[model samples]
Each structure stands twice: as C-alpha cells, then as structure tokens.
Target chain A: MSEAVLSIRNLTVEIPTRGGILRPVDQINYDINRGEILGIVGESGAGKSMAGNAVIGLLNRPAKITGGEIWLNGTRIDQLEGEDMRRLRGKHIGMVFQDPLTSLNPLLRIGDQLTETMLEHLDISRDKARKRAAAALDEVGIPAAAQRLDSYPHEFSGGMRQRVVIALALCAEPSLIIADEPTTALDVSVQAQIIALLKRLCRDRGTAVMLITHDMGVIAETADRVAVMYAGRLAELGNVRDVVTHPEHPYTDGLMGSTPLASKGLKRLRQISGSMPRLTAMPEGCAFHPRCEFAQDICRAEPRPKLNGGRSACHFPIQQPAEETA
Target chain B: MAMIQVKNLTRIFDVSKPWLNRVIERLPKAMLTAVSDVSFDVEERTVYSLVGESGSGKSTIGKMAVGLLKPTDGSVLINDIDLSRETDGGKLDKARSDIQMIFQDPYASLNPRWRVREIINEPVSARGGNVVGLAEKLLEQVGLSSLDADKFPHEFSGGQRQRICIARALASEPKLIVCDEPTSALDVSVQAQVLNLMSDLQENLGLTYLFISHDLTVVQHISDKIGVLYLGRLVEEATPDELFENPKHPYSQMLLAAAPKMDGFGREIDPPQGEIPDPINPPTGCAFHPRCPIATAKCSAERPEMRVVRGARVACHLAE
Candidate 1:
C-alpha cells in the first residue's frame, strides 16, 4: 500500500486500577491509506473505540495509551504535547461519533459548529467559512442547507443531524475521518442512504475513512479493508472481502454466520454461543477461548493473541475458504 | 379461529393547534391519522409482523392492540373480545393481562433504578398472579442468570436488557405478546439470541405474537405472516414466504428491495423512493402512490381496498 495517512503501530491502552494496570487494548497495528476505508469490527468493549480515541487524542481519562506510536503522515502523534495534538486535530484529523445529538452542543446552531472548525483550522474569514458551511451541508445531502444552517440539533431529524455532523467533519477537509458507528442510530432505510452518502463522499474526495462499527453489512458495502477486534486485541486484519467473506478467526467467522443476510432465506441464523466476557479480568490465553468451538488446551495458556499469521493471536485459525465461510 | 382480529382499526391523534388558535388562524383541526382502516388477524401461536417506516403507524397499531391507546373507529378483537374506548375497567384489565407489549427502547421501557427482579415481578405482584420461582425461572427462560435479576438495568448489555424485557413480558403469562421492535436496539449477535429466545418461548408457552418492526430481514425470520403498513393503513398482508417471494404491491416490493440483503450480491433494483407522506394530511386515494414508481393516475384518485391476490391481501389498483 502507498504511504498511509494514519499509521498505528504497536498501540496498546491500559486502564490503571487499585490492583494493577488492566490492559484494555493490546498491541495492534494498522494503517489507513490516503483514500482507503479501513473498518474496525468487534463486539462492544472490543477496544475498537479505544484504538480510535488513542489515535484522535481523545481517549477519556483513566484510560491511558501506555505504549504505542501513532504516525500521522510520518509525524509521531502519540508523543505530541497537548497543544500540538490540539492544533493537529481539525486540520489533519476529523472525528464523527456514533451519537450525533451528543457530539454537537445542543445550544449552538448548525452553522456555528461548521464555521468554528473552518475558522480554527483554515485561517479564513467568517463569511468565507459561512459560505463553505452551506456547501458542506449540501455535500452531505442535507436539504435546504442555507436555511438549515441556523437550526439547532433539536430542530433537525435523526438522519439530518448525522448529515450535519458529517458536514462539520468534512468542512475542515481533514485527511483522515474516524467515524464510530455513524449510522447505527439511524433506521435501516435511512441507514442505507447515510452509508451511501458517506461512502460516496469519501470516495470522490479521496479522503481516508476509519469506519468503526459492529455491523458487518456496513463493512461489506463501505470499507475497503476490515480489522476485527476482540477484548482489546486485533483478531484479524485483511482486505474487506478477505476478512468479511474469508475470515480466519473463529470469532469473525461466528459473527458472519450469525448475521441474517437477505440472500439467506428460511435457514436459521447462527449465533456466537456466549456473551462477551467482562473486560475487568480477561482470560489468560485467547480471550475468545471460552466461546470458540475448536479451542484446545494450548489455546488457553497465552495472555494475548498474535498480530500476524494472517489472523491475530490464534494458535489454530479456522481454515475455511472464502466461499466456505459463513 | 384467529387469536387477534383487527377490522378497520384507526387512531387519529389530535396533534392540531389548540382549539382557540385554530379558530383565529382560520385553519381546521390538524389531526394526524396515524393508523387508517388497518385490518388483519393474527393466528393463534403464530408470529404476525407489521413492517413499515416511522410515522407509518406500526407502533400506533401495536399500542391499540394492547389497549394502551383508544382506536378512533373500528375494532381490535383479541380472541373475539372487541377492545375499544368503551371497554370498561374489568374487561380492559383482563385484555391487558392477556396481551403484554415489549417496547422499542429497552432502556425506556424498563426502570433503570429498579432491580431486574422487581421489574419483572411488578406485573406478577400487581395482577396477584401465581408465578412461583419467578425471578430465577424468568432469567433462565430468557437465557440470563438468576444473578442478573438482582442487578440493575445498567449492568446488562443492550441484548441482555432486552432479554430482561422479554422476561418481564413473560411474567404475566400472557397469551399474546406485542413485540414492538424487540431486537431493533440490539447488536446482530445479541439480536439472534433474543429472536431465538422469543421463538423458543412461543413454542414452550404456546404464545401468539403481534411483532412490529421496520426491518424486513428480521421480520422474515421471526414472522409467520407479514403486513406492510403505509400511513397507518395495511398495504399488504401475507405469509412470510409469499410476501418476500412474490410481493404484489409496488410499495411492498420497494420496501423488500430497500432493506440491505447480506446475500443479494447487490443486484440493481430501484429502492422505494420518496419520503413518507405526512400522516396529518395523507395523499388522496393510496397514501403510498406518491412514493410508488409504478403508480398510475388511477392510484392517485382511487384507494384500492386490500384484497386476496395470490393468497395475500394487497391494496394496489395495479395489482388488481
């Protein structure tokens, strides 16, 4: 792959407690190319969001990125001080969180949110930023952008609020956009429309997207590559087609099998056997060993998973071919 | 005999401006016709699903079926018991006990402050129903542990909370469960667990379900029969296999195609176009005609009554 816009290498996050450091995100490495869409898939508490936060310099307190290097266009961002990271945020990196209503301040009008980013990042006048704001809204397919700019988040519909969030993200023209479960809150019909909009905008603008979600259907249709995380570790990383269609990890395979594809009719959908264990105390060996069908004695002795071998941490990954999988 | 029979059931919410303001503005009362002449019957121990967009009145229909809302006109007969505003105290309580409802938002439906055991036991204690070993039995029934019953709603996952909701619904030992978007708020992995639990419960308890949701793929799996709603009206109703395979109404066809099918391989079929029409002022004739690509001039002026076409009741002039 060409030089990555955002490269995360040997990244790990630890949450300290009375006992000791609880490792939430194990050492994982991945990169988002200039225009590529990298999907991070996992169940809740998979450390996918943690990884995204670590890169964006927005990981909440008590959650520490203990060790790792984040390379943003060859600059070591992890070591950057507070102001440097702050300066780098909107100009280089943009973020769209899952809940649009929460991301945006309730009181501020939509126009203010968009213009604030442009003013801070691009040395442009308010008028110029204001003009850019209307155009940005249009790009995200928000109808009546000019009139809508003055409306607060409450006035806009769920789907429209998301479009406004996207507009704010794109207004700065950041090289990388990390969207965390952006469309999960939206309805299926509106969800399809939003996904289509996000994918198209990213494609045409050649902007790299770090799409983090638990939905495989979204990854299948939008992401260029997929990274499957489990209990704070990368379970599998490969091209979207490879990871989605021919997953090597049992967890990945199980996730795919469980999803009820519209194509599959009448057949009962499969489900992963157990709930994701609590993250407070992860298992010694593979985190997924408790639920894996093919787990052997050897699988339980390790603390974490491997980052290579075409699948992460697995001593014996599922060998099903692409077509045979799911 | 049908376990639940709904005939011309409608709910028109008075969302109009205040009475005095309407007079001053020289405007008529703007009533939102949430459900319009919706008619269907749910068979005993079978899953009948209503699939549509928000504002289409799917939830309103569910509310009416559970006696939570009064129907403006027509009737909802559950086991030959006609439910209406006139149905007084004893009859209403009996009807409610027989038909329990699971809401869309698990967080909202359940009290966060209350323990799971208390939430599930509320109905049991209120009705003075003899449900022995309730908390533990219900937890196990919904694939959760007895320990979870003592914990608050926050402690559980989205899927787990929904399981608790199902457990709560089961506490009454209701004959019919109105599941309104039961799995919509959950993840795919968790959704399977809930759907499976619901199916298993139905089999074990001989429960009839009036399942409501906007998801077609999900509806296909859980529903024995499916009904497509538009602006509170039942556009089409049929068996799951029949509706999915040979949907006659243009709106029905578009809805099926709009849902992202994991296996379809993305063959190009035009999705249902146009926004959902305003419920307060729905279009003349067929409400879905404005959005339906195949709608002719006749569809705009004349409402097509639901008729048996290919063993499915489809309301489309074109289908006729």
Candidate 2:
C-alpha cells in the first residue's frame, strides 16, 4: 500500500450559535497519500473550508473540533496545542488562501517574508536564506527574482502575487500543502498557470496537497481523488475519474449536471430544486434526503448512511447502466 | 431594426497622478482607453454577450450601452434615439425609461435599508407611475413569494437577492436590460435557476439583454451571439456554435483551450504565454501581438481590422 501522508478519521466540527449548536463538518473521513492531490468540492455552506481549518488548528473561537483524529505523517495532530501547532504550520504544513493580499504582509518586501519564514523553521544563516528566497521565486517562474526581491506585494500583478504566495508556502519545505480556492480570484489564463505550477511542485517534491475548491473543472484536471461534501457530511469519495465521470450520489449527479460545459451545446442547465439546508435547520434523518431524488421512506426515517467500505454515503448508489459498463 | 446600436463607442479614463505629484515626478498624463472604438448591435429580444478577462473593458462597454457612463467619443442609439446627444428632455427621458440595468454582486446592488417592495417599486414610483401591486406581481413572476416583498435585502440569500434585483429591473417594463455577471456570484445550481428565469423572462416579455461576463461556459450557454474581447478590443464575434467549434482568432482559440474541461482529466496542455498587457501602454499595432503564438513583422507594424472570415468576424491578419 502507498504511504498515507495525511489521514483524517471521522472528523467533526461544531459551532455554538444563539439559535443552536451547528455541526459544520460531520463525520468526514479521507486519506491523502504522499505526492497526491485530494480535491474537496461543495457549495458555499457545505463545511469544506471548516474541515481544512480544523486540520490546521485555525478554527475560530465558538467553533471547535468536537471529535476526530488528524494524523500527519503518523503523528496525531488533532490534540496539538498553540505553540506546537504554530511550529507545525510553517515547517510541516503550508497554506495558500483564496486572496493573495491577505496571506502576504503588504508592508514587507517579498524577500523579507520568505527569508523570515525560512529562518524561523529551517536552521540556516540569514545570508543563505535570502539567497534561497530569490531561488524560490525563480522556481515559481517569476522573472528577475533577484532584483524584484526588494519590491513590496503591491508591486506585482494579481497572477504574479499568487506565484509569490506559492513560493512563500513552499519556502519552508513542508510535507503538505492546504490550498483553499487558490485560483478562484484569478482569470482563466492565470488560473491555468497556477494549477500547472502546483501540480508540478507536488510531483517534484512529493508533497501531499489538500486542494479545497468549488470548481469542478479545476478538480477534474488537477485532483487524483475527490471528496464530495453536502450539508456538512461526506456525500461521496472515490477516484477522480469515477467520481467525476459517473457520480454515485444523487447530489453529485445534480451538481455535475448543473455546471454548464463549454463543450456541450446550448441547453437549459439541470438545476437542483432548492439551496443547501442551513446548519441550524438541518433535517432529522439524512441531511440530503429532502433535496435528493432517490430518497425513500427509509432514507427519511433512518440515520444518514456511512461510507462503511463503500464509495457513497446514501441509501441507494446509482449503478452503472449495463450498456455503458459493457 | 436593432433594439440597441453601439457605434464607435469609446471611453478614456485619466489614471495619472494628481497634478502636483505628476509635476514633481516629471510624469506625463496616463490615459486608459477602456472601450476603444467598439461597435455591436443587439436585435430585438436577442441575447448578446461580451466576454473577456478582467480589465478587458467588457464591463465598461456594458456601462456605455446603458448610458450610465458618457462616452468620450461616439454614441449609443436605442430605438433610433441617442441618449447622450439628444437635446430634447422628453425624448431623452423616454429613452432612458426604456432601458434598465442589473448589476453583479447581489449583496451590494440591493439597498439594505429598504424593504424589497420599496426597492422594486422605486423605478416606477420615481417616474410618477402607479406602483400598486407591482412589487408582488413581479416577485411572483421571478419565482419569489409575494410575502418576500416586506423583508429587507439582508433577509435573503445571494440567489434570492439576485431574483429581487431582476424583479426591480422588470418593474419598469424596459425594452432592454443590461446584465453584468448576474450569475457569477451564485453557486452552480442556483446559477442554473437564475439563468433559466432570465431566459423565461426574455421569451415572455420580449426583452433584449446585453450580457457581460468573464465566464465562457455560462456565456456560451446563454448568449445568442458572443463577442470575444482582449485589452479593450473586439477580436472575434460569432454564434456560440461557430465560436466554440471553429474559432478563427488565436486569442479566442487560446481562451477556449485554457478553460478547464469536465472530460479533460489527466490531459496536459501547454500554458498560454504571457499575461494581459498593461492597458495604458498597450502594444503599438495589434494589442495581442505580444502574446500571439504566430506573430510576424506585419502583425507588429499594422493593426488588423474586423473582417468577415469563415462565417465569423475576426480581427487577425493571418486568420484567412
């Protein structure tokens, strides 16, 4: 079996509100191997980002990891506290967020940020760290890295700033990367560049990446495996080819059908009937039963199904048509 | 006759530093030609879409078409009446009333302090038109309940707020509506619902739409005609079928190729070269010359005019 770089088992996150206790992420499980890209896809309130925040130990107050285990490289990290988790962040895990400006300090020079990260995590001289910072910029394909080192974050364009963010994330040589909507703010051309850079870096350095995005196309082109989330639970998880080409879960099928494809001719998009259920007002049985087309009396009466050695968490997984399977 | 005619519409913004700063720094005035000599026409009850990346001036053109921003040069004629140059007050008011706009970012577009009823009826009330039961009728027409009229914008979700905006746009019963990225902010499933509603409204009311968006897939699905823009210039225009199947311009081909595909799993593509050029100091001849894969001395020395080629209007010297 391949080495698992990150293993998350039955992870659950809860937030206490005035209305009630909200479980944003509920009983999610997945394993990301070394040098693999695991894409988490869902809608706005689907708790995809909450799961990632829990792994990094960055959950805001009032929101807590109620249950689960997060194992990184064989070490149980869910119980790690502040100082220990801070140390683990730069040295063992790197992050790239949706907005580049928020990640980078606007006042500091690009080189200073990179060198400071390296000096804090790696045992190296300041001079060496500075030199490595320039090389890091070069690796991400920024032109004139050495001269541009003194420039502030505002000096670079949106795409170039994102490249710098990628360099900073990888400067400490972490074993895993958590990129949440990294290309959502970028144009198509620039988005392609960033995706290619992330893919190449993962392959070359054997880094495990947990890429969280709502774009199916990005996941289709980049991920080796995909996990579909709906209403704070794992709807389906499998190989990217199987999940995207033929989704077993009814919700996943509806999502794929709704996304308008450029390759397809003009036609009305197949819309899911209603919006995702809010966390506070979640239904009694399966969270997706109300919106699911395959829901039965059993689905509404029984608790939500667990993956339990199968790919999808549902009462009835869509089977492959005989003709297509043949 | 076309419902909307935009002729040589141009808008230039002064992006230079303030007077004292420019004098101290010995800098010249910087002008950004946001929409440079762009022309297009939308027939009655048809959907015409302008598509490009950020800073490509698609939004600027949409603003010009709606008379929200006066053009530095050229004009926009709606129903044979020039909104910018028409001196008669009665004629200009009537033309303005015939046009309405739907903006992107549903969160920002709707007024939060007012009830949905007042927000929808403001268009009619401001013009001294009777707004009795107008809000409820339009709300029901847009798939929202009549009870929603009493709630504030904060009480609704993103898709619901956009539906309210559509209701407000239709309150005036305008002949043409300009939609700028109406569904870009919504989730995919909700986006499908909103697009379908827009299509139904157009068919029922015989309304024309000038849609501006950065998403190619959504544009291809919704537009009757698509205009591809690059650096404030229209590079190609065609039906979605022709544009997607047989793209003549290199830039159009690159855009279609770069858009992530559903069945493109494990496929490798050579990333397109270079980013969009600075609009202020654009290229000398063709704005796309610097990034064109096939470029020669002629491409850099002379600008290409839009010409009919292979059943599409293409602005490339080597397109033939």
Best by TM-score: 2
True contacts kept of 1: 0.29
Candidate 1 lDDT for residue A88: 91
- Model 1: per-residue lDDT, tens digit, A178-295? 9999988876667777777777888888899999998877787778888999888888888777676667889888888777662266446788877887777678889899999989
- Per-residue lDDT tens digits for candidate 1, residues B80-140, read 7776754477876787789888988888888988998899999999877765679889998
Which parts of model 1 have CA positions greater than 4 angstroms off? A105-109, A144-155, A322-326, B17-28, B85-93, B111-118, B145-156, B263-273
Docking class of 1: acceptable
Local error of candidate 2 at residue B309 (angstroms):
0.6
